[model samples]
Target: MTAPDSSAPLGVFDSGVGGLTVVRALRELLPDESIIYLGDTARVPYGSKSPDTIRRFSVEDTQFLVGHGVKAVIVACNTATAHALPLLQSTFRVPVIGVLEPGVEATLSDPNCERVGIIGTAGTIRSSAYQYALAMRKPGLQIHAIPTPLLVPFVEEGWTDHPALESVLHEYLTPLLDKGVDTLVLGCTHYPLLVPLLKKMLGDQLRLVDSASTCAAHVKTLLEAQNLLRLPGEKPTLDIYLTDLAEQAEALAKRFLGSTFNKVKKATL
Candidate 1:
């Protein structure tokens, strides 16, 4: 395989538009680096799928990104990262980064973080990727992980501030709060959109570790270490691709990506 050029765009993929949150973060941190994001919207919500299915889908997603000549690939979906990151790293020539490690590193970066609570999809929580990683790095650390499956749909529906969402948040987070967790990791990329509501409900004490932002920072570090950072003075561009473009894709993209939302093209894989 030829070496990835510094001028090549970084590739990022998720089960759906949620990965745009990562793109938003990347745009802010590495303004000169162009990005190619693919959303496997046709197979949205890989969380409930079997591990084998998730791995297959993730490989196809990475293949699509690699075909586009991306410098690196970011598995932005927590479920995919949990199940397929190892396979992707071994299979791909370009750097493969997952959202899990960065979030784990950020959570442990807090010296006072003894008890940590993680909320993600069923697949992510069931796989215990975050839980295992945390325990491995900080032995004896108290870790509580729950799968808040409904939260993803609510976020994608743009119901972030809906009254019903408050009830769901309480249902999901009350147990974690009761455990007296000092930190909470937003394991899913889509969860960041709920941060405002989360802060409003949980208030100032709970330290929220956002996977999207931390993953973006990690990507920047990796690119720099490998001398793949894009040169300055070149205007960066973002290209979005979706396997299935729903009618609300544009609105959802805007919701997750804010001002950085770009027109999405259809992806075959």
Candidate 2:
């Protein structure tokens, strides 16, 4: 397959609207590059799915993006990244980027951090991707992972600070705090929305690592290194596609991207 032109849009896929955080970062970092984002809302929350199912969904998402002539593909879902990144990288001709390694890199960057905590969906936690990556990088590093599956739904519902949500957060984070974790990685893109609440609860001592911006910076570096960076100072088009119709996706896209998306269409695998 021939490499796409520099002007070709970059593709980004996620299980749902959570990937918009990545899109926000990409737009801030690469203002002139067009983007094609695919959200598999029809099968949202790959966090509970089997590894095989995640891989299959990721492949279809890649194919859908490739069909649109994307210059590269970004797997913006941590769950999908945990389960399917290697396969996506090997199977696709375009560059494939995942959220896991970038977030892990960010987490390990803090020199003072002795114990690290990670919070994500069940699939990501079950995959143990963060633990394995950290171990491979630093065998002696201490890591703790907790699955906060309910957080996704809470974020989607715009309930970032509901009393019930706080109860759940306390329940999920108390154990990690007890473990003396000085740094916390928001392992899922959706979790960024809860940062304010998290900071209020965890306080200043606990550093929060947001993968969205880190992954975006990595994408910029990769594009520049490959001589695939687009021209600057131009307004770029963003094409939005979802496997199923989701009103919240559009609303959240506007919230995260800081602009209204004029075109959103339903797609199928």
Candidate 3:
């Protein structure tokens, strides 16, 4: 067990650079606490993998972050959050939070939201993670899920907007728009890059829901609930680790993290 007074970083890990979105939101909300982020870039998209593979990778990712002295961990990938959250929470000694549950809670707690649509990769949509969570929270709410595999690769390429994006957005989102969804959940972390285009595609009639901000707020609340907030006068730090792809990692880091990080290092795990 970790020591009670441990001042270790809180860990967040995802399958690729996508999780930088989550890290960005967390940094804004908890400016005084250090964060350790791990991106298993070599494996890239977990959206195509099987449940067993996702669970294995998730456990390994969490274990790798725990080795870096994190007191808590967040599974920032929707796929992992769907398939591996239970394993992570039960196996890890520290508190483990997944993006899916908190995001569902946020959507459900907001009374204005009645019909919600979800856009994500195949795995997240197929897992029906968001739907299950939403049904549990608000049994009668309508939920639509559309699988979007292209968005992840687009975001990874640092191409947030292009002529191709609009067509893709319209193709993937038109059904949800026609369904008259009031709130659309950007179910994948990578989807945030397309917020502007998606909003335009859906028009002012539909509201875009970002799980990143909600998940970050929940992280803050979780820390406070457990009395794990950072100590006074401590200089907050952020350490980023990735599996190879140093250049892509750096570019996305700058895109989401806003500032250049001199502390980023490459690691296999």
Candidate 4:
């Protein structure tokens, strides 16, 4: 493995377009750093796949990014991180970070945080990664986790404001609300897109811990510590790649990335 250079782009990948939220956060927090994002649209939603399959897919994804000579790789997919982070870190020479630990740390940062609610894909919840991490940090803390499999599709459909979405959200959040959870962890990257609606529905008392922003902050700290931060004043670029581009890929990318959206190239992995 070659020595990591400060000017090299940061590589990020997910099972699909949701990882763009991480890219969006990175662009805001580390404007001087360039980014290379890979969305495996061809095999989107690794949530339902077996752990072995998820690990294999994640290896290929990391291989593709490492081949591009990135300074570090960020596993922006919650499912991928839950299942394959250790393997990827061992296999790759560059620094490998995941979205899970940062979010967990952020969630527990508040001393008053007692009751917590977590919502993510079925696979992420089933893996118990977040639950385990949180419990390990704060013993006897009250934690409630729900598998919000339906929320992802609604978010992708751009129906955050739809009246029907309110009902769906209500159904998913009632258990947590009943348990009196004060902090809510948005476990999936796609969940950040619904923050506005979530705030309006859940109100101000419930603190929302967005994994995307927390992960970006963590990335910045790590890069700084390793002396790999790109120098300031140099215009940074964001290159996007996808294993397969669906018809709605561009539109969905725009939704997740907002103004940071760029033309995506096809990645043969």
lDDT of 1 by residue, 1-269 (tens): 58999999999999998999999999989999999999999998898899999999999999999999999999999999999999999999999999999999999887989999999888899999999999999999999999898998899888999999999999999999999999999999999999999999988879999999999999999999999999987688899999998998878898899884557799997
For each candidate in turn, the TM-score is 0.97, 0.95, 0.94, 0.98
- Clashes in predicted model 1: 0
Note the Cα lDDT for every prediction shown. 0.93, 0.88, 0.84, 0.94
Regions of model 4 farther than 4 Å from truth: none
Backbone collisions counted per model: 0, 0, 0, 0
Best by lDDT: 4
lDDT of 3 by residue, 142-188 (tens): 99998988887677666777888778887887888888889888898
What's the true lDDT of residue 237 in model 1? 86
For model 4, how does the per-residue alpha-carbon lDDT over 11-71 read when each residue is reduced to its tens digit? 9999999999999999999999999999999999899999999999999999999999999
Pitting candidate 1 against candidate 3, the one with the higher lDDT is 1
Best by TM-score: 4
Task: Itemize residue pairs with steric clashes in candidate 2.
Answer: none
Cα lDDT over the full model 2: 0.88
Give the clash count for model 2. Answer: 0
Which has the better lDDT: candidate 2, or candidate 3? 2
Please give the lDDT score at residue 40 for candidate 3: 92
Query: What lDDT would candidate 4 get against the real structure?
Result: 0.94
